[model samples]
Target: MNIIALEALTFGLGRLAAASRKHGCSLTLFTRDKTVYDYELSLLDEQNIKVVEIDTFDDHAVVEMIRNEKDVVALLSSTDTWSLHCLDVSKSLGLPAQNADAVRIARDKYQLRNRLYEAGLSSAKSQLVDPRKFDNESVIKDISYPCIVKDTAGTGSQNVWIAYDKEDLLQTLDKAAQEVLRGQIAIEPFFSGTLYSLETLSWKGETRVIALTSRITSQEPYFREEAFSSPVTINHSISAALEVWIDNVLKSIGYGNGFAHTEFMITDTGFEVIEINPRLGGVQIGEALCQSLDINIYEAWIEMALNKRPALMDVPLNIHKGIGQLIIYATETGEFSHIEGLDRLSAHPGSPRFYPTAYSGKSISTIVDQRASIGILLAEGETSEVALLNVFAARNKIRVVMKG
Candidate 1:
C-alpha cells in the first residue's frame, strides 16, 4: 500500500512511514518539490518514499490515475492548496477525503460557524466580512463588542486582533485585513476560558476519542498554538461537555471518517466549538500519544483512508490518563545564536519536558501571525502548570542572535 503524505512538517513523513512499516505495510511519499522530493527519495528510498507524480487536482484524471494503482491511500491535508486538491481529487477516487463536505469547515471559519448555527450548537457568534469594510464601526456593531478578527483564508495570524473595545476593534481592522489575501475575513466574540483540543479518530459513523488534551497558545488575542500534550489527564466527567460537543461536531460537519483535530473553549457557557482541523494534530501530539499508549493513530488513520479499519485499534482503551504539552513561544525574531540546558533539561527527573525548536540563524517574527517565525519550545508533563513551566524553562535556557 502506498501512503501519500502532503507536507513534511519537521517530521510528518518519517513518522507515517515508520508507523506504516511497523504495521507491516509498504509506503510512498508524495512531495511538492522535485529536488527535495528526489533528495528524500535518496534518503528513504530504502524505506519507500516514492514521489507522487501529479500535475494538478483535476478530479476525473486523478481518479483514472489511481484506479489501477496498488493499495493507495491519502489522508486530510495541511498545506492550503495541496490539502484542497487532496480532498477534491482523492475523494473522487473513493479514497480518504470521505468527509469532502467537511473540508470547508477547516478551510473557512465562517463555514464552521454556519454549520454550527444550523445545528443549534454554541460557538463564538461570528460572521464573514469583506476586508475592505471590516473596519466600519457599523460592521463592528453587527457582531456586537469585544470580538475577535482575522483574515478569512488564513494570514496564519499575521494581523489577527482581539478587540476589547470599539476603538481597538476599528484600529485593528486595517492591519488585519491586509494580512488576508482573500480580502475576506471572520469576526467573533473573543473566547474567554480554558482552551483544549480533542485530537480524535472517527470510524464510519462512530467517533473514537483517544485523546482529550489541553493546548497552550500564545497569550491570545491571536490564538496560534504553541504546544500540545496527550491525555489531558482529566476525568471524562470534567470534560463531559467536550465529549458531547465532539460527537455533535463530527455529525454536524458531516465527518463520517478520518482524523480530526478540534480546538474549543470550555467556558461557563459550556463547551463552545472554536474550530476544527480534519487532520492529525501537529506538534507530533499524535505521535506522542502513540508513544504513551502503544497505538499508532497515524497508521490507523492510513487504514481508514484505505477503506479498512484495523482491528488493533479496538485493543481496549489502555489510556488511563491524559498528557499535556506546552509550547514556549519566542519573544523576538533572529537567528538562534547559542543554546544551553537541553542536556540538563533532558536529564531532569520525572521525564524532562523541555525542548527548544529554534535553530541558530533563523529569523523569528514577533507578531502573533509571525509567532511561529520564532519556532517552538516543547514540553510535556502531567499537569498544565508542569507542562507550561517545562516549556518556559526550555525557552529560558536558549538564546537567538538576530543579524543586525
Candidate 2:
C-alpha cells in the first residue's frame, strides 16, 4: 500500500517516511517545490520515500495524480497551507479523513475567533476587514486600541501587526493594503501574556495533551518565532485547567482526530485562545515530542491516516527530557553564505544539533518573519528551561552570514 502526502512541514519528512514503511506502506509526496524539504530529504533514504514535483496548489492536477496511483490507502497533510485541500481530495477518493467543515473553520482566524467567542471560550471577538477598503473610523469603533491585525489564514507569522495606538493602526492598515494576503484581514483585541502551545492527539473526539511548548518570539511589531521549548512545566492546578479548556476548545471546533497544535495565552483573567492548527506542530516540534516522550510520534500520523487508532493515545507518556529549538535568522536580506561557529556546537552542554533551512547561493529576502530563518538549532537538557538556556548558549556562538 501507498500513503500519499499532499505536502508536509519543513522538518519531519524523514520520520514520516520511516513511519509509513513501518506500517507496510511507501510514502509519496506531491509538492511544487522539492527544495523546501532539502534538510529532511538529505537525511532520508530514497527507497521508500518519493518526491514528485508538481503544482500542489492545482486541485485538478493533485486529484488526477492521486487517481493514477496504485494501492493508495491513505492521504495525509500536516501543514496549514494544504490541510483543507488534502481533506477534500481524501474524501473524494473515499479515504479516511477528518471533518472538512471543522478544518475549514480552524483554518480561518476570523471564523475561529467568532466560534470560540460564541461558545464563551474566549473573551475577544474578531472583526473581518478588507485591507483595501477598511476605514479607520470603522476599525476604531469595532476594536479598541492595542488590537492585532493579521491575515485570517496566515501561517508562520507572515502578516501580523500589533496596533498600540491610532497612528499605529492606520499605518498597519496602509501597510496591509499593499501586500497580498492569504485570507481576509482580521482585527481583534490583543491578549497580553506568555505565549504557549499545547501539542495534542485526538482519536474519536477524545483529546490528550501530549506536551506543552513555550513559544518565544522576537520583539514587538514583528512576531518572528525565535525559539521554542517543549514539555513546559506548570503548576498542577493550572495544567489541569488548561487540559479541560483545550478539550473544550477542540470540541467547540468539531476537531475529532489527528494532532492539534493549539496556541493560547495565560492572561490575568484566564486562558485565552489564540489559534488552533489541525495538524502536528511545525518546525522541530515533532522531533521535540519524540525526544521528550521517547516514541516515534509520526507513527501516529500514519495510524490515523489509515483510520486506525494511534497507539500513542494508549501509551503512558513519561517525559524523559526537555527539547529546545532555536530558529537561526540572518541579520540582513541578501545572498546566503555559510553559518559561522557550527564547530563550537560539539563543545556545548546540550549536545546541540544544527539543521540548515537555507543553502549558499540562495537569495534571501524579508527579515521580518519566518522567511528570514535559515536554520534551526536543537538541544536537550533535564528540563525545558535548562534546554532553552543550553540552546541559547549554542545560538550565541553561531552567526548567519549574508552577502547583499
Candidate 3:
C-alpha cells in the first residue's frame, strides 16, 4: 500500500514511515523546503524509499496531488497545520480521518478547555476572558491563585506564564495583548502536585493506555520542561488510577479511533486534567520509551493506520528499575562555547548519553521549552535520584558559548 506521511517537525513520523516501507509498504513524504526534504531524503534513503514533496499545503494543486496519488491508502501528519490540512485533503480523498472536528478542539486550547469543561472532565477551572471586555485585575481575582497565563494556540511553552503576583500577572497579560496575540489566553487555576502525561491508543472501538510517561519540569517560575521517561517510575497505584481516568477521558471525547497525548496532575485534592494533544509529543519519547522497554509504538501506529490490526507489544510497564530522560539546555543563547565535562557526560553511571546536535560555540537562542533541547541524556539506575544525578552531571559538562 502507498501512504502519505507528513514530515513537518522532527516527530519520528519519518521512522514510522520507514517502518511501513520495511514491512513492504511505500510512503510519500510531504515537505515544503529543500532543507527538510534533504534531511528526510537521507533518512528515507536508509530504508530505500523515495519522497514526494508538496511545497505548500495552502495550494489547491497540492490538495489535488494528495487526492490523486495512486494507491494512497492513508495520510499521517504532525504539523500545527496538520489537523486543518489532513482533514481537508483526507476528506477530498476517501481516506480515514482520526477526528476532523476533534482536531480543531484539540489544537485550540480555548476550544479544548471549553470542551473539557462542557464534558465535566477534571481540569483547572478556566475562563476565556478577552481583555477588551474586562480589567486584568478582575480576571486574576476571579481565578484561583498560582494561575497560568498561556497563549490560546501555542506550543513548546512559547508564551506560557505562571503568574505569582499581581504585577507579574499584569505584565504577562500586557505582553500577551500585543498584535500577535489575537486569540484568547487561558486563565486557569494552577493545579499543583506531580504532573504526568499519558499516551492512549484508540482502535476498533477499544481504547487502551499504551504508555504512561512522567514529565519532569524545570524548577518553577520559568516552567520549562526538562525531560520525560516512560513507565512513570512512580507508584503502581498512581499509574493505575491514571489508566482508568485516561480511558474514560478519551471515550468522553468520542476518541475510539486514534492517538491522544494527555497531561494530568495528581494532587492531594484529586487528579485534574491538563490539556491533551491530538498528535504525538515532539520529544519522540514514545519511541524512546519503546526502545528502552522492548516495545515498538511507531510501527504499531503505522500498522493500525493502514487498516491492519497491529498487536500491541507486552511492554513490562513497571519492570523498569529506574529509567530517566534529561533535556539539555544552553546557559545562554550565543555562539558554540565549550562543553565542560564530556568525559563525565559520556561516562554516565547508568546507560547511554543522547547528546543533542549542539556542539561547542554553536550559535543558539535563549528560549528553551521543548524545542530548545540541545540534547537528551538518558540513564537507568537503581534509584531516580541516582538517575537525576547522572543526568545533571552530564548536563553540567556542556558549556555553551552564545553569540553576544
Candidate 4:
C-alpha cells in the first residue's frame, strides 16, 4: 500500500517516509516544486519516499492522479496551504478524513476567533476589515489602539502588523491595501505576553498535550520567528490547566483528529488563543520533538491517516534532552552566498547542527520574515532552557553572507 502526501512541511519528510515503511506502506509526495524539499530530499533514498512533480493546486489533476495510482491506502497533508485541498480530495475519494467544516473554520483567522469567542473560549473578538473599502475610524472605534492587523489566512507572518496608535494603524491598513491577501483582513486586540505552542494530538475527540514549544520572535511589529525550543518546563498545576484549556479550545472548533500546533499567550487574564494549525509545528519542530521525546513523531501522522489511533497516544513521553532551533537570517537582502563560521559550530557546546533552507545563488529580497531565513541551527542541552541558550550562542557565530 502507498500513503500519499499532498504537500508537507519543509522538514520531516524522511521521518514520515520511515514511519510509512513501518506501517507497510511507501510514501509518495505530490508537490508543485520539488526544489522546496531540496534539503530534505538530499537525505533520503528512493525506496523510502518518491517525489512526483505536479501542480498540487489543480484539484482535478490531483484527484485523477490519485485514481490512477495503485493500492492507495490513505491521503494526508500537513501544510497550511494544502490542508483544505487535501481534505477535499480525501472526501472525493471516500477516504477517511477530518471534519471539512472544522478545518475550514480553523484555516480562517476571523472565523476561528469568532467561533472561540462565541464559545466563551477567547477573550478578544476579531473584526473583519475589507482592505479595499477600509474605514480607519470605524476599525479604531471597534478594536481600539494596540491592536493586531493581519491577513485572515496569512502564513509565515507575511502580512501581520501591530498598530499601537492611530498613525501606526492607518499606515498598516494602507500597507495591507497595497498587497494581495489570501483571505480577508482581520483586526484583533493584541495580548501582551510570551508566546508558546502546544504540540497536541487528538483521536476520537480525545486529546493529548505531547509537549510545549517555546517561541522567540523578532522585536515588536515584525513577528518573524527567530528560535524555538521544545518540552518547555512548566509546573504540574499550570500544565494540567493548559491541557484542559487546550482540550476545550480544540473541542470548540470540532478538531477531533490529527496534530495541532496551537499557539497561544498566557496573558494576565488567562490563556488566549493566537491561532491553531491543524498540523505538526514547522521548522525542525519534528526534529526537536524526536530528540526531546526519543521517538519518531511522524509515525503518528501515518497512523492517523489509516484511521487508527495514533500510537503516540499510548506511548509514555519520556523526555530525553531538550532541543533548540535557531533560524539563521541574512543581515541584508541579496543573492545567497554562503553561511560563514560553520567550522566554529564544532567548538560550540550542545553539538549544534545546521540545516540550510536556502541554497547559494537564491535571490533574497527581504529580511523581515521567514523569507530572509537562510538556514536553521539546532542544538541540544540538559533542559529546554539550556538548549535555547546553547543554540543562541551557536547562532551568534554564524553569518549569512549575501552577495549584493
TM-score per candidate, in order? Answer: 0.82, 0.98, 0.85, 0.98
Q: Candidate 1: where are CA atoms >4 Å away?
A: 22-24, 33-45, 51-81, 91-96, 133-137, 155-159, 310-313, 320-324, 328-330, 336-341, 350-360, 365-367, 370-391
Candidate 1, residues 1-404, lDDT tens digits: the string is 56555544443455567667775666654444444333334446464555566553454655565565587656435445455677766656666465567766666777777778778886445677676664465576656667877665553445467888767776776666555364367787776788888877778778777777667667756666666655666766876756667888889888867677777887887777777777666665765677567666566755665567845447675663334454544455554454444566565423544333444564565645434443444455555446555555555555544555
Give the CA lDDT, 0 to 100, for residue 346 in model 1. Answer: 63
lDDT string for model 4 (136-214, tens) is: 6787785677999999988987899999888888888889999879888999989988899999999999999999999
Model 2 lDDT tens row, 183-295: 99998889989999999999999999999999999999788999999889899999999999999999999998889999899999999888899999998999998989899
Model 2 misplaced stretches (Cα beyond 4 Å):
none
lDDT of each: 0.62, 0.90, 0.66, 0.91
Q: By the TM-score metric, which is better: model 3 or model 4?
A: 4
Clashing residue pairs in all predictions, respectively, total 14, 0, 15, 0
Deviation (Å) of 371 in candidate 2 = 0.2
Query: lDDT, candidate 1, residue 131?
Result: 60
- Predictions: Cα RMSD each: 4.0, 1.1, 3.4, 1.1
Q: Can you tell me which runs of candidate 3 are displaced by over 4 Å?
A: 8-14, 33-47, 56-61, 79-81, 131-141, 165-167, 179-183, 313-322, 336-346, 355-363, 382-389
